[model samples]
Target: MSRNAKINTLLLVLVAALAVLPLAFGLGDHKEEPFTGADAEAETAITEIDPDYEPWFSPLYEPPSGEIESALFALQAAVGAGVLTYYFGLRRGRRQGEARALARLRAEADADAGDEAASERRRV
Candidate 1:
């Protein structure tokens, strides 16, 4: 295959491996809750270290269940990804537009120079 195609395929494979390898190997299998968030783990650790510890503040809003909390987290991630995608797309489009404008300007200048040369030849 072509160089670019090979590179793209390699990147796709690497991304898939990154996503799959951790799950496949069960990297966090030793943990009590393998898929638990860091916040929950930290809370457990803190409470274990200090039984009478009290929080200075609490969340303004809390989801009713773990499923809802996961859903909200996923939604937040999706929104963040969308925002980043939009920003990058906008930047790419602007770059393409600027490149096209520069190319058009160069072509016009060359054409104008050619026309001037023809006119001078006719005058001579």
Candidate 2:
């Protein structure tokens, strides 16, 4: 068989091995343990503001309803959408560039073939 065929076969075997290995040895998983202690001190270890520190700026805007959780969810959604759109757009642009390069290569090869054919006719 050709070198490329051997390479592809090797790659296929590697992918198959990767796929089956997880199933052969039972899939690894983490088990959650129930909370043990009623530790109020551990729970209340949040950072406290100093009484001596004066406010630098006045609050200009009021947050949306259920601000803490809702705002975080909204921010996460917006960021996720932005990142996904950017990633896909970048990929699409790269695909278009590759297609154009392939077309140019095909055109150049066609032009070279025509020139060779014309030279052959001239020689004949």
Tell me the spans in candidate 1 whose CA falls farther than 4 Å from its real position. Answer: 1-19, 52-58
Over the stretch 47-82, how does candidate 1's per-residue lDDT look in tens digits? 999989999999899999989989999999999999
Please state the error at residue 2 of candidate 2 in Å. 37
Error of 2 at 106 (Å): 1.2
lDDT for model 1, please: 0.95
Q: Which 10-residue span in candidate 1 carries the lowest summed lDDT?
A: 31-40
What lDDT score is found at residue 7 in candidate 1? 100
Give the poorly placed runs of model 2, Cα more than 4 Å off: 1-73
Q: Give all candidates' CA lDDT scores.
A: 0.95, 0.77
> Per-prediction RMSD in angstroms?
3.5, 10.5
Provide the global lDDT of candidate 2 against the true structure.
0.77
